[model samples]
Target: MSLSEKVKERFRRMFSDVFFKRYILGLWMMAEGLVYDMFDEKLHVIKTLPDTFDRIFAGGDYGINNPTAFLLIGQKANDFYVIREYYYDSRKHGRQKTVSKYVEDFQSFIGNDQPENLFLYPSAAALILELREKGIKYVRGADNTVIDGIQLVSNLLSNKGGRLFAG
Candidate 1:
């Protein structure tokens, strides 16, 4: 006799080891090879930024209740350096800034520098709209996949052919 669908589901839930193996064992396995010191300060920190770059770009993370941050990046050949940063925390400052104010901050942060692209947090629709209205060119949402982003950064840092550094 065939079991009912509900009974089959219950049986699978009671008997299956998928969750235990995938979540529990997987975590332990990943922890073993996980890099604790991905960016060695001596190797990846710069005291001075180059005068010229092949490409210039910016990245932003827009937050209202949380902290907001932006990075001005310059690239020469295969190396990328963070030339400047802007960070604001409303909670710590005890005052929240409006969307217009944030947009103004973004503009001020950019100054006369013309970034080739402005990559932003994928969910920051309001901020993106404001920047687009301000005639910022090449404003696009960044890839939001955590694991893929982590892997890409790791590869960049680990490879001798290219490097990502902060100043």
Candidate 2:
């Protein structure tokens, strides 16, 4: 069966459970950094990106003290898949990665996907400006509300209709 068809089949099988009937109605709850917590459906590991999303989007949060983190997300309807990641931490090496270095690694990590899928980063004025100078275009994410963003991600990851596989 096709991937979506397979997903539908799984959903069909799971839908008959009394517990899952309520799961369909529970999508309206709060889920945050608790994304892993909200994953009610079976996990999937996909070797290739499915042709289901309207587009891909990336979101990043960087810090001088903590590590820099980025997530490549695929969006379908209102849900998302974490297709890839770019993470760096200078603390491990007892030194920080320079702005230029971070820019270079970020570019290399993204590789030819630019100007296609939208790239977004949380408001980091200095990092954003520096990255812009390096031919990377990034739009600011909305509000940068930790609770809200986490909840949104959790909701997507936990949705009973959500199908995800990490490969």
Candidate 3:
């Protein structure tokens, strides 16, 4: 079936169940452009990205207490997909995680699959250096313009009929 039909059916199914009324109402609010101005729940499902994507990229945002995130993204044409992530809060570790430790996890996360591009937040410069020192070259700084990036991602998630999932 077509995507629009799928969306309509999905909503209808949700609306049919009284227990899901609140969630469906929220979806209506979003469909009317009244809520989640940057969210695209369609792309948040558990599914795989298309094989047309040729490049894999990884990016990191570092934080000692706050959750530090590393996303592995796949890109095809001008579209993007979030394939996987390594999200952690050092507080959960019971102590602040060192840059070396984060790098070690990052290495294990990527495994033998070296990404074509690696972007790191400025705060992760030490981790970037450590990665390079470990001979895992190919790192760059991510241009993390929140508003602009959100707008772009929202647009892509709406227009591109593809799947992206991360855990």
Candidate 4:
């Protein structure tokens, strides 16, 4: 493939670092898009989820003074579903949870569901340590690639081919 100098310069100016690396260097990169304006429940929601999943995973955000959240996600092929969510707000609840208490709650939240991995926000060091110390397996810090994650989600949700959806 080849491009004129003008076109190359325009590409360089228009793309972000990640996009430039992918497009110009023949490597993977990211794109720009939005999903909030495109959300439609009629298109995205489903009444039932598959009884079995090809993969199961969980994501968690730890908070001492703010809000903590955990999502249990199940996937079958290209489809994803949020099977359950656990959320707690310290301000609304009137008190903070001890690290051990949070861990106990997290374990209970997991219950019989076996998640292949648990991805926690990268900066949630305290929670990560507590979970690890409690003998949790496959716990890893989440990737901090914000733009890449957003673009991928936007494409999956808004793409006309309907390759992916979350319920």
Full-model lDDT for every candidate: 0.80, 0.63, 0.70, 0.80
Q: RMSD for all candidates, in order, please.
A: 12.1, 10.2, 7.6, 10.6
Candidate 1 stretches greater than 4 Å from native: 1-36
Q: What's the alpha carbon RMSD for model 3?
A: 7.6
Model 1 Cα shift for residue 32 (angstroms) = 19
In angstroms, give how far residue 26 of model 1 lies from its true place: 30
Better of 2 and 4 by lDDT: 4
Sort the candidates on lDDT, descending order: 1, 4, 3, 2
Identify the runs in model 2 with alpha carbons over 4 angstroms from their true place. Answer: 1-35, 39-44, 51-53, 115-123, 160-166
* Clashing pairs in model 3, backbone N/Cα/C closer than 3 A: none
Q: Compute the lDDT of residue 8 as modeled in candidate 1.
A: 64
Task: Report residue 136 deviation for candidate 3 (angstroms).
Answer: 2.0
TM-score of candidate 1 versus the correct structure, residues matched by position: 0.74
Whichever of 1 and 4 has more TM-score, that candidate is 1
lDDT of 2 by residue, 1-167 (tens): 34577776777677533334445434444543333543544354455676666776666778777888877777676555677888888788688877777778777776755524334454577777778787676555447566886665555555545544444
- TM-score order of candidates, best first? 1, 4, 3, 2
Candidate 3, residues 2-79, lDDT tens digits: the string is 358778678777553322444644433323433234344444554656765688889888887788898888777665
Listed in order, each prediction's TM-score against the native is 0.74, 0.65, 0.68, 0.72
Candidate 3 global CA lDDT score:
0.70
